[model samples]
Target: MVDFNVRLGLTPTDLELREIQTKRPAEFEALSADDSPELRLVEAQFAGKIVSSRLFRGEKTITVKKDKIVAIAKALRDDQETAYNYLSDLTCVDLLKVNKTEEEPRFEVIYNLYSLATFERLRLKAQVTEDDPTIDTVESVWPNANWNEREVFDMFGITFNNHSDLRRILMPDDWVGNPLRKDYPLGGEEVEFTYNVRGR
Candidate 1:
């Protein structure tokens, strides 16, 4: 057995420092709608189509929309005011609220938007159903969304409408169902381990 000192790479002094340090959520806030370039791009491109807009934690903001996500994205990337040239990362999360189906989907699709020039970040989100999870693809704005959308599609089963090519990126081409749905089961681990691991 490894000693406590050897088990953890951190020294006792390091642990003491960590224990004394008070941790708190980051105090990040986004710019106001009137002052934010992202909002201006939204007004210019989407006009009254935006459903609602709000700022959260002051670091990021969200603009809910009901139509033409692709078009709005294109304008944001091209416009000088909101030159969101970098698609930093794309991912999804499971709310696990069962109502997020045909009846209701407590599930939410969160989009993290960032700009290299402005050094600002925003979140664009849409609600979707589990039965027919569909959202517009941002691939037109960022070609990289081609694979990002596919990852969301493969794991969470959220369909991206108008995606140039929709296929599994991490899973096999003919994967049967979304693996990240929170119900796919942990059945494969033992089977995979027994098949591959040679007993000592």
Candidate 2:
């Protein structure tokens, strides 16, 4: 005998939620750079933290590291053998109304990196704290980062350290707040009309 609410999807199983947590090639150990240095140097850098990473495969992933990002990127590019010369893209993540704890950073900054000499591709990620929400800009090493960082800051409420012009690119300059954070109330934060009112 099941209650109507239970049959109507009001309850979820623990196993179902646990299964959703483990996607392929993405686990806590997998996030560390030390874990996969033999396979990929970049992986070793993010050791034991997959919440900040999205592994696309054995070789590539997207990471969100909000601290010392510029330094880490510079080290990789000038590593002689790993000279990541290509910046494929820079993007932002918008996780609306998620269970984000203030102890952890909430925003993602994604970098698509490539080595011209070896024709290898890797992705880097850095997360920014909600209060400050800032990371060093990589425009010095990759000029393309200039525009990309600006776009992220404009739309996603990120602040790039040492960015030349960190201002709104897509939205008006006087925009009130970043509309992407998980805590942001969706659909204007309240249901305007109720199903009971329709009576259909």
Candidate 3:
């Protein structure tokens, strides 16, 4: 057993800190290495579908075409060698002002998958253009995607085709705009105070 003695504002000793830091790089290197079996499996399974792959800080992120997401997701979930059974999270990113140097798409729907048995994680991104911001639903592959997909749709206006019930999960059904988008209006509702109430 190990004792961390973790408490608010409590500083760890140099030896303890060094020990923790020393183990992180080795773990990261193991995951980020090109020889990982899971990585090879992913490459083999989705060869043509993969648009780009990147490794940053010991984490792998793979970008794929929006249309091929469902097939790729199904492979990741059902494959015994790469059983990414847990859908840890699903979200979208509005790349309106991001990576201006590259001609990347306007939006990207991201899926975080985890393997409870193997204790591994993978990140998959499917790019969606502003003109046609839609992707096939992964709800069939991972049922939890139902709510996560709805949240992404509500926040980024990205549609998930064949989703059981795609609707706004966080915002009102009549909300004017996707607040999370970079170009969303900054201010809208009027501030209310006791003085303002008296005037009204």
Model 1 alpha-carbon miss at residue 3, Å: 39
- Full ranking by lDDT: 3, 1, 2
Question: Model 2, range 1-200, lDDT digits (tens) per residue?
Answer: 22433344443453245445744542433444444332254445544433444344455564544565776687678777678888989987754334556565667688888888778877777776667878889999899999899888876788888898888887667766565554432332223365645655
The CA lDDT at 155 in model 2 is 68
What are the lDDT scores of the predictions, listed in order?
0.68, 0.66, 0.77
Q: Kindly list the per-residue Cα lDDT of model 3 for residues 110-138, writing each as its tens digit.
A: 99889997888888899999989889999
What are the runs in model 2 whose C-alpha is more than 4 Å off?
1-55, 62-65, 95-102, 182-200
lDDT of 1 by residue, 136-165 (tens): 888778888788888888888888888899
Clashing pairs in 1: 28-59, 29-58, 29-59, 30-58, 30-59, 99-104, 100-104, 100-105, 100-106, 101-104
TM-score of 3: 0.75
